[model samples]
Target chain A: MPKLWNETIEEHRRAVRDTVLETTAELVAEQGLRGVTMSRIAERSGIGRATLYKYFPDVESIMAAWHERQIAGHLDELADLRGRSDTPGARLAAVLERYAFIQQQRHGHGAELSALLHRGGHAAHAEQHLRHFVRGLLAEGVQAGEVRDDVTPDELTGYCLHALAGAGELPSKAAVRRLVAVTLTGLRPQG
Target chain B: MPKLWNETIEEHRRAVRDTVLETTAELVAEQGLRGVTMSRIAERSGIGRATLYKYFPDVESIMAAWHERQIAGHLDELADLRGRSDTPGARLAAVLERYAFIQQQRHGHGAELSALLHRGGHAAHAEQHLRHFVRGLLAEGVQAGEVRDDVTPDELTGYCLHALAGAGELPSKAAVRRLVAVTLTGLRPQG
Candidate 1:
């Protein structure tokens, strides 16, 4: 893998990008979203501002890229849950356990994500990938009779997000799971 | 009513306070959180700046008052649901329906709310009240057997907010309702 010069060059670039994102992530998490900026990120990353700008045009792009990275990680972790033999209930619990850690990351690993979301950029790839991944999961649950067949996965995913956001209250992992249970069992239409 | 007015000047001040808040709410709803400042509010309400300042020292105060007023409304609406004979599932549906509207308020109502949440001081009231309203509801749901009884309402509410803000897929109310249903059901206990 290291023998190819182009591949080696690409690896170095990726390493630099990861370092910059990791530093920015920590700053955002520790200080909250408002403190993040290209200058600050570059300074923290130990790279010159010019060098950093070459990689990222602006602070928003940096945040956007960081968010995509985090989402990718989350998706990868949940990838196998779709095939798990557990009922939809168990599957959701397992997913929430994973998500809860991600959520807890707000004070650290999640800082950049939270900042980016608040900053408000809707990149197309991230949006489509998230929707498609969730849609696939709900479809699996329905086929298994572990989750209700009537409602679409998109709806389910949205509700989980808002409820987790605590539209009415803050949501815990347990709260998320219980809500899923009622949804899979209670909200399903009767024949 | 005329006779009552002579004895209830306090009520009149409260009424005026609400009108001032409504003015800010309307403007912010139309413009954005940035659009709301002492001067804009005073001019829009046709109340002098001094008078507006007399009621609310800054945008934060105005926001807190607005949120508190809304909290009063939410409590009133959900009061009957609390400990009522309705299934936890039904009660959660009721809550999400209300939240769908709350989110819509963001296109306008959210700017000021955002301003308030991000800042501290009198703005702290809004955040506190907002959190309180959410936790109170989760507590109710926990008792209803619709939400998992094991978790704290605060953790649930916090995670939900982070998730709602993170979910990049949702755009409309119909979508929000479906997502909310999925989330609420997920929170139900495993048994």
Candidate 2:
């Protein structure tokens, strides 16, 4: 095939895949994980069942793909925050605040979906990447004398992540910010 | 009936119920939650199946009763620590250390059982009591000027609980203690 023809075909396939994933997410959000079906996803995405099947084997595979995309997006957002031109403390605060909000937003996905998506290799891989990403930021903060050096950066990362996870149960964005503030205080140097 | 005979019958019933709860916990520890059954619990406790049924409808009720007892015991242990004659900071450290250890020990119970027992009224009530108990300690620390007063005791309690929950995933008791130390540091007055 000609190069232009090949490029057009690849772009079309990518667009179709994105549509299927987004449509499935909307369906799940509207009707719950149990209510979603492959046929419904196909109809909603405006793709034939045959084309949808070519992209995903079933509803579970589609949901997994969607979750993977969401995790990737979150990681990228945190990275962007880390890359901002500011004091290390300011960047760290921004990342922690955003992470807490993400944790709070995750509560809307429901426990059943969480249990399903939290299992398997993808979630574990994402967790490792997230830990490494946060640890790097903490190391930067420590070198700048903004974060405490008494604890290892790895342990501090664990502390921050576990502490902010409570944001999921918090009542509001302001409460999540308060939780983040308390967590940040824990990372400060001792007197 | 005579009062003496009535007292003896009540004592016997209490003994039977205690045996059933303990035996069910042992069974779950040895063979996972799904392996436990009403017959197995009755047999292990050396009680008739009919008598066991009179006490608990099935394995789930038995487990629920055991979890409730465990939660109550933990709260009492923390309360005892809080009541000890020491500085407020010392008492808070002791309670937090014990709480972290308890959270670590809970990891042995398996996720299935945790899910089952964490739902419904008992877990929520225990959580409320725990928050109140921890908040009281924080208030005492604040009064002594040992703990930070910038944040409310209620928020600090939430922070401490959520942070120490990571102890469940820590590799050792030493690590759990380290987690507790970090959390306590966060509670200290800022310079």
Candidate 3:
């Protein structure tokens, strides 16, 4: 094949894969995890079963891919937010508020779907990346005298993440902001 | 029937139900939720299949009942801890520490078990009770000036629970304590 033809084919493949992943996620969100199947995803994505198989082996794999993309996007967003602010504590709060908002959107998906999306090793990798990102910001906050120095960065990182997890069950965006604010306050050094 | 006979039968029935629930929980801990069956539970408890059915309609109901008992036990433990401490802040810290330890013990129960146990209405009720308990402590802490007064007790209650949830994944008891300590520090007013 010509070079132009090869590049066009790769681009088309990427587009189709993204479409399939998005369709699968929508189906999973509307129905429970058990309700999703390859045929269902294929039909929803407007692709043939054979073409869908070429992109993903099964529904689980497709969901895993979707989750990976979501995590990557989230990490990128947090990175961007970190750059926008000069103060380390302020940056941490911004990232946490965004993180809490993300969690709040996941409410009412049903536990089964949440479990399926968070299952497997890739989710673990994403968690580690998130923790490391938070820990770095916390260390910066400590040096700036905005975060408490009594606890190590690693411990503080766990505290922020854990506290923010409650955002998923919060009633509104304002509540999520309050959660972040309280968490940041908790990080300040004791008198 | 005689009153004495009726009392004896009621006591025996209670004993049998407790045995069945205990046996089912142990089976679930050993195997995933899907591996458990009424027949297996009946056999393990040395009860007739008909008798087991009399206690619970299905595995899910049995699990719910077991979860209720667990929640009740946890609430009782927290209440007991509350009575032992003189200061509001100290009581809150003690309860958080115990709660963290409880989470740490759940580490090896497998994610599937955790998912199954957290799936129903009883879990929601338990959470409400836990939050209410924590909120009360936070209110007391505020009066003592040990906890920040800027946030409502409801918000701080959420912070403590969310931060301490990470204890479920900590590497050791000491790590769990550190997590609680950091969480407590966060509750203090900004200096």
Question: Runs in model 3 with CA error above 4 Å?
Answer: A1-3, A26-50, A143-145, B1-3, B27-50, B57-60, B143-145
**DockQ of predicted model 1:** 0.32
Task: Using lDDT, give the best candidate's number.
Answer: 2
TM-score of 2: 0.91
List model 3 lDDT by residue over A19-125, tens digit each.
99889888987886888999999888899999899888998899889988988998899989999998997898888889889888866676666777787788899
Query: What is the DockQ ranking, best to worst?
Result: 2, 3, 1
Task: Write one digit per residue (lDDT tens) for candidate 2, span A1-191.
Answer: 55798899999999998999999999999999999999999999998999899999999998999899999999999999888848888999999999999999998999999988887589999999999998988999999999999888998999999999988888889888878888998898765
lDDT of each: 0.62, 0.90, 0.86
Give model 1 RMSD, 1 decimal.
5.8
Residue B25 of model 2: what lDDT? 92
- Model 2: pairs clashing at backbone N, Cα or C within 3 Å: none
Classified by CAPRI criteria, candidate 3 counts as: medium
**Residue B74 error, candidate 1, Å:** 1.9
Which has the better TM-score: candidate 2, or candidate 3? Answer: 2
Per-prediction interface RMSD in Å: 5.5, 1.1, 1.4
Q: Regarding DockQ, does 1 or 3 come out ahead?
A: 3
Residue range B1-191, candidate 1, lDDT tens digits: 36576559888787789789899878777877776788999898888898888888887678767866775675566555545636655655575455545555444444436656545454456546656766777777788766776556776555444434423345666665655554555455655
Error of 2 at A31 (Å): 2.4
What TM-score does each of the candidates earn?
0.66, 0.91, 0.85
